[model samples]
Target: MMRRIGLLIFLGLLATLLIFPAVRAEEKKTDGQMPSLTGNIEGGFRLVDVDGSRNKFREHYNLDTGPRLLNLSLNGNYRSSRILDDFRLQANGVGGDPYQNYSLLVNKDRLYTFEASFKKSDYFYNTITYPVSRPDGNQTSFEEAHAFGTSRENTDFKLTIKPENLFKLTLGYSRMEKEGTTFLTALTTAVPPDVTLITTPVDEIDDFYFASAEFSLSIFDFYFEQDYRKSDNKLNFLSDPTANAAVELHESQTVKESLQTLRQPISRAKVHTLLFDKLDLSTNLVYSNSDFDVDINRPKDQFQAVRPPTTGEGSLNKKIWIWDMEASYSLLNSLTVHGIGQISELKQNGNITFTGSSRDTTEDGTVINKIFSHTVGAELEYVPLKDLSLNGGIKRQFRKLDFTRISQFNPPPPIENPVILQSGDTIYTLGFFWKPLTSLDFMGRVLIGEFNNPYTNISSTDTENIKFRVRYRPLRTLAFSATHAERNTENTTTFFKSNFKSDGISIGYQPVAKLDLNVGYTLQEGKSFSFFSSADAACFAFNPDAVNLCGGVNGAFVAEYQARSNILSADALYAITKKIKVGLDVRNIESSGTISFHFSDLGVFLGYLWPYNLETKLKYQWITYDEVVLNANDYVASVVTLSLGLNF
Candidate 1:
């Protein structure tokens, strides 16, 4: 019924447009007049090969063989416009372990304008492998072992309407889906009895609706917007996985089955204004109230003849709420600042349910859990010199987390968990743009991690980031540019968490405007922000002897860290004739040793007006791991992907 209602509303809007009087031609000033009807569509295809093999800290450092996968993709976009009229449509479809983006867009204008579209994106895992050795001497097997390929999906819809003057309204809907979370697993013994390692999968759904309206007032840039949004969610159970379950592979594992569903609502209002032509300021106030339940399942069982007698039952529902507000200001020719504050509350009022031969029982527990967060930041980029510029900013945040829970059994649990976090951050930047002859500029972000967060265990990390760049335009078509960067992350978790003190340098060259090349290399050793205690040890090792050695490796898995790695990417395009063209693209990475990932893509084009386009990509790679998983090289795997696309 809801779907039908949505369709009906969409149809009704379309009908209203048809019944309205014809839209007269728009009369806008222009240096010259030309018949509209102008647009171009470009479509291309890609193929990728991925190794699904589980990667080990050893292989990550040694460069071993792992899993191999194949993927294909096609994308395109087009737009047309006249004196005062325009329209656009764009779409792209793809499948791969990498995050995929696909969207559709349409724009039109009568007296004003209206636009609507839908987009979906998916982020997949990095790789996977198998036949890894357990911390124990025996080998372990994961019929479907995946180092990374869990996925996060984002689906959203939007609508925009502008009626010449007076007001504009926008309504949108978005859903965030997180599925199949990964966990490092390991076993203690070769023979499995009692229970095999099982780390539950984590999944969740967040559905929301947003609507906002803006009214134009006064000659100055003045506007106001009111927003309303609500969220509803559903949660389910994921498979129990094992391997790094006991190690420091991750910060903290989810206590629940790793999946959840919730329903939340939000509403907000903000007014923005510009006093002068060069200065702008805006303040926004937003409040969100959500009512939802978070539940964890407890399995019923009989432990060693002590039949706990607990069967077929679960706990009551728990809830959480969040509220936040933000504001910002920008000077067209000078500086900018932004700030926000938020509060969150969680209720623990839940009743437990139990079953018996003669009666069913319900129990209640203590309600608990609350958190508050605040942040403010600003940046000033001033061009005081004709060829030099300065940029800097400061940010601060404070957080407090409290939790509470009660049990009918003996010792009472804390009413709430206690955690406090705060930080004071700052950044400084410098740049130079000089027309030394014709075409040359230098830019850099030689910044630092000035945030000092004392509540928890943290370090004052430093940065040695520097970039040298230059652009030359000897002639219009004969343009070229080059750049190089030397960067360092000292015990920092800024651009990426788990990044250790490392140095990386990258160089890129571009010629003929259509061709580009880049290469980068990095080396590092870092600690994970999670389970890694000040003391280095495998937090999971059952014995004091192996704990430090085994659990410590998990901290080495950095979603953003490619240690001892090298990367190369390049793209080139050439017009063989007026109707035919060719292009080439390549991407390669060497995490360690000779074991690496590489992709070579080729493309061809022919025809005009209603043109024809086609492209193909070939990829290859082998991976390996170390003490963390398989015995250095206990596992191996590979695959290849091919794709095709067309444009009109």
Candidate 2:
């Protein structure tokens, strides 16, 4: 109702500016200081316990059981005030939280400044099951009856005028909302086409308006901005022909869909300069235009056995352009030079119309799309000594695409070509940094790329990337670090290949005088190779005849995938006196080859300082998930939190 009365009058004007600076803390004194209030206010209570799949514990920690405002802050400052000078208010996870946030800021110094923010989030998903091989060679297991959940909200407001330098102005507004439930799939004219799952309801909304301007003299600095956006989407589908009764006989439907979108006046410009005193420059521009509309309704459908009702309509137009430029030079006193450029363009047009009740399901369609892109780069840097540094760079990129499709269905349609694509890439880079001693340090980077698409065969003609880092400190509390990364890609006309690798190590320690420590480890690997089709490898061998396994060159083959991950982390802190403190955190993860998993996390915390500026905290957490090949999507969770605070 009126958005909960405008969110309770914006939380009662932020609780009257957070209690009017603590009730005028001893009044009197405007320019002689007296308006100062620091921040802190916290409250919390949370407990959660789950032992196995509450849909994988809400897909991993969507905590519940709570009374919380876990954190809040208020800050104020009024020195020589006519109205206000500084203010801030903050909040987090209010109550009954799946996620929540609130923020406010006000300032009146060089005229005005104001800001507001709000956020909320929640989402969940579940649906997994495998094994299905039948065509008389029986094997059964299924559960792809989809599931999705959602809740999203965001709001923002901003106002700024004259602050931090010559000529400035700003205005803004934003809103977003999403609500949901999902699952949709339909087809049931029987005879090898009986897949039916429908349960969909979703609503979405978005709105935004923005404005900006800034200017500065003496050599240059300028900016401009304007924006507008709107979107609305909805969907509802209801079908339950006895809900997939052992897979078949499903054709009772009711569907409705609508979509609307508009984007206009989205423009931006920017410029920056420093000319002569070692030269530096920047430039940017952006443009946008968009339009969209869609509608679909299927009053009731069961077709052929007569139940008919269908309709559809669609429209779209889009445009986008972007530009960028950058420059830098200091060619001496340790040399430096850099340059960059970018450009982008896109255009699209669309149309679709359908009305069915036979006539072979009336249809009409048209669509066109185009794209262009460009990039250029240059870089050079060298620092003869004094901790050493060297770098080199080169870049070139180009892209072009065109697509078109037109139809008016009749017994003639299989392939009607109108597609074009052009691609190019050339990238080379090298980087380095070294500190030859005094506790050592080193860094490295290398990249190589070359690509040319002769109209794609899954693109990627050659690519490689490598990185390395190292750091060490003998003692003063000991420290060490290491990292390595690699990437590779190749696709000599569909002999596709891919690779990725990573390694990391870290350690930090403070050993005494109040203890502190940290440890880390990470490893990741990935591999891929592709070329399928034997009716997609017989539907990944779940084969229900897979449409009688299509023809061609021994039905094509070669398909491989691999993934690996290992991570371990640890942290600790201790102070136990002068107001006490303690903390610990641990995490572990292991995953191997094509979807295998094990994960664990443990956390502990305790803090106290009660004596006037009161503060207290206690936390505990444990989480685990093991799904070595879907053990019914394993899960285990436990969490507890307690907090209290006051510091002003």
Candidate 1 on 525-545: residue-level lDDT in tens? 333332232124333322333
Model 1: which ten-residue window has the lowest total lDDT?
Answer: 71-80
Candidate 1, residue 36: how far the Cα is off, in Å? 6.6
TM-score, candidate 2, is 0.32
RMSD of 2: 29.9
Candidate 1 Cα deviation (angstroms), residue 441: 1.5
Overall local distance difference test of candidate 1: 0.41
- CA shift at 383, candidate 2, in angstroms? 85
- Candidate 2 achieves a global lDDT of 0.74
* Residue lDDT tens for model 2, 1-648: 236325634763664655565436534543356677688888979898888776667756678887787778877777455566777778777775777777788777877887877778887765434333333343323323355667888888888898545677999988888886665443345554355556656788888999999888778999999898888877666665444332222234546555555555688999998988898999999999888887877555542436566678888788999998999899898998899999998898888777774554666778888888889989899899989999999989898888877866655462345888788788999998999998989999999989876344355478899999999999979899999999998764445678999999999999898988999999999998755443355534533333345324343444456889999999898998979899999999998876678899899999998999898989898999987876877878889899888988
Name the candidate that leads on lDDT. Answer: 2
